[model samples]
Target: MIACLRLFSALCLAALLAACASSPSSSLGELPRTPDATIEQLLEQATSAKTPEHAALLRLSAADMAFQQNNPARSAQILAQVPLDSLKPAAQIFASTLTAELAMGRNQPKAALAALSHPSLQNLKELPPEQQIRTGTVHARAYEADGQTLAAARERVAMAPLLTGDAAASNHEAIWSLIAAVPGEQLQASGNPVLDGWITLAQAIKNAGTLEQQQAAIDTWRAQNPAHPAAVQLPTPLTRLKELASQPLNKIALLLPQQGPLASVAKALREGFMAAHYQAQQAGQKPPVIEVYDSSRVSSLDEFYKKAQADGVQLVIGPLEKPLVKQLSARPQLPITTLALNYSEGDQAPAQLFQFGLAAEDEAREVSRRARADGLHRAAAMVPKGEWGERVLKAFRQDWEANGGTLIGVEYVDQPVALAQQIADLFKLRQSEGRAKSLQSTVGADVAAQPSRRQDIEFIFLAVTPQQAQQIKPTLNFQYAGDVPVYATSHVFSASGDKNQYNDMNGIMFCETPWLLNTTDPLRNQVTAQWPQANGSLGRLYAMGVDAYRLAPRLGQLKALPDTRIDGLSGNLGMSPSQRIERQMPWAKFVSGQIERLPDTPR
Candidate 1:
């Protein structure tokens, strides 16, 4: 009777373990009531299995269950007990792949590669397409973990043809993201014809600006390599590419105030636009013939428009001053499509005119949106004392309140005392002091009093220069509101300031063009190399010029598909229904006297 009881207990344990290992879901939802108990039970059952094959299969199932429960170390331990060679070919592949994946999860890239080196796992094409793709993905991840980024990207690109539906879309996006991360100059021709073709195609697509150029590029590639496999699959991406490319703008007229207060800015823009033109020309593209018109030299925008029309210009890209832009917008019908450098004052702009500029109001609105996204609900603002500052503050308040955030307080400061008093009022520091005095009086003896700032304020929307920011940030901390976050526009970053000087402005977050923040970008480096004098204030204008030249041809696509965004040098360029080209810039925080880019936030 004692021996039979022991046998019954062993059978019950094996049955429970078998039931726990049967479910195959990737998540822990299918695990037994107690995962640890199930794993222990599985080990006991594996040791008492009837045959070696049964034991190996039981161990593999336990390893999978352990992994599902987020126990990678235990999973690896269970996998080690299994004799992979004793299993069937499919089972061996399964065990090896799972071990490799778990090893990768533990950041053991070498161990992962070792596990994947099994003979059964080699020659993945022998497996079904789905299995092959899965194994290839693991190999690609292993390569990435080992710091072989190009190798990883090439692995995915090689399998791009086999992916379909959501898999294909995700793979395509990953491939492009990796390729874009590598500088254009570093993309050399791989010895393989297929890879070389892909490299060449990627370069061509990068340079192509319009539908005609894209189609011509595809035709050229097809003619060069008629039998390549990519040619057969080219139509898939082409459909999406067609949505981004629009009709070509062969003749463009650039209008600027060449001899006025804005002449320096205009010069920077002209140089930047010409730089893009030269780049396209060098890439064997038939760039638009651009004509420069001095808005200051012409009597009115009408004369420039007529002149541009007579020259058969397909698009007009200027009128930099706001008043001039407003004048252009008031015209009954523009001779050609005009991309105004500045937006008009009214809500509605002319139908034929599209506006694109680095506007202060846009930056303010972006700052408010970012603050709200950061979970900051109550805001206080410190703005400069001027018309531009008023516009920025008003725009920020409107956007903040519209997004269900409250504007707790606002102050316009032109001096130190003004800023201090405004901050004190915003935080109700004086009220705290008055309350502390009243409590001391009620205590009927001289006592130490502790004042507290208002807890309602969550963030500060600061519109100030870098110089002002340096002085204001520390003052806010001294005033007992240091814990509250501070957000600002690109104005807080001079882009070429002394890094050490910005140490005082630490903890300030702002948004700026990737062109300024990512100084290592190939295009930015090239532009800086050519025009070493372009820095600080003019640098942003230069980026605007490069994007404007690229945007002229793609405007129709932006308008047609609201979801479309072109990755431009200035920022991610998109269009609003009001004909304003919106810029979505990257975010950065000043840390240790340097501007560091924040992790990308989802749109």
Candidate 2:
């Protein structure tokens, strides 16, 4: 694990090297030109500097070198010694940018943004183009980390004129990535011609009917805006898209169990996949011919693949059972590209096998991301007492700690009768009561003292059922923890449309599928019109099924371009290295017996 982390850190430093242009020699101020100087030599020079400004410059250079060497701790230590308010404007900007970079390394994007906002940055343009590019790139990265996609794209767009050669080419690709990441609804005309042109180009490709039509749209966009930077040289993803257009998926086989414990699940998935297929047909786009195979009836996996290949199946989109997926994952290779509907336990997956699922782990990780984004660093958890809960807690802990959050307390929730005591124990309310008694005894009389829960807990990470959540929320209020924020997984919501039920869950924020939240989604509306149960908790499975269909043709697109995301009913979907599909869900809170969708940042 340590070796893997070292490899990851090395890759990260290599990626950031493009933005690490050398500091202008003029900022060094009479210091010997020792471009090859070690960190010790730089700090030694700083200690003997005659002027404070020169000392700050030396420290800044040392910090930059430390960061380049992947020693963020040493970089942060050196940066802390440089008194920013006492430094010259140029040195101040240099220090501030370096500070931002270090903060970002710590997963504190808000802190990074604050560092970059130093007043000294107003004179950034006066610095050399290298410094400007370095500063702008860091600023863009901070915005991206903070979930301000438009701001990040705009920053990159502003840096375009100042960039050239490999730097310019890289920034051009980055700008498109940031813009493409923006949801279709948020991709608006910013009224800046250059940014607006790029926005329109993304919208044109997104809204185009077919791959051929998308290629045509790109060609037309370039023709209409010949002066646009993207027109001069298309982003690499677009170049890949042009190649994908000629080789379309011609046929698909959806492998699922027709009769088993998961038959009902298979039904929902099939309906959802067909719903998307019919939608494409209705929209005048020619979707590939689809064949459904009942895996439960198949005697052999080899025979199944032999039939599929004989039938000219280019893509296989299921085997919703975990055991079946595990079987496929153990193979050296698959005869056809398979998008498994469920994920297996281990990381070893064949090159042709891609896993996608509606795993609760995704929601747990989403809670961590949202909680940290809300500035809640200290967390307590309440999850059901079972293996499912263990999995969720594991996912949350891994992501939460990795993002610099502290999980201070946890309670394995069991019976409803035990909830009040569990809540009290989690909040240290019993200790508070014990302290109150001690105070009364010391005073030798009755003293008025209200029990106070631990103030260290900033929020609660909750993973429970709808009924359990209904009981848990009011129990927390009874235990004096109602005021503390609660970040919950989607399990807490049943989509029952019961105002009284929702009122019980009031003040609890949860991540949920866009299908349940977006009442007006055309596909969702149509699907629910036919299968009303799609309006309930079952809707998430249906949404996952819809995403599976959307993912089938674009799997190659996603594999080739690692950053590509498909906004689907389930979530904002991306691919992991193991070919598992990861979802970033939208968040919503219960307010006044209604579910209120929230902005990416905390309210």
Steric clash pairs (candidate 1): none
Model 1 lDDT tens row, 203-223: 665566556676677678778
Q: Over 4 Å off in model 1, which ranges?
A: 1-247
**True lDDT of residue 27, candidate 1:** 24
How far residue 135's Cα lies from its native spot in candidate 1, in Å, is: 52
Summed backbone clashes in each candidate are 0, 0
| lDDT (Cα, 0-100) at 253 in candidate 2 | 98
Residue 120 C-alpha lDDT in model 1? 71
Cand. 1 TM to true fold = 0.61
Candidate 2 lDDT over residue span 410-450, tens digit each: 99989889898889989889999999899889989998888
RMSD of 1: 15.1
Write down the RMSD of all candidates, one decimal each: 15.1, 11.0
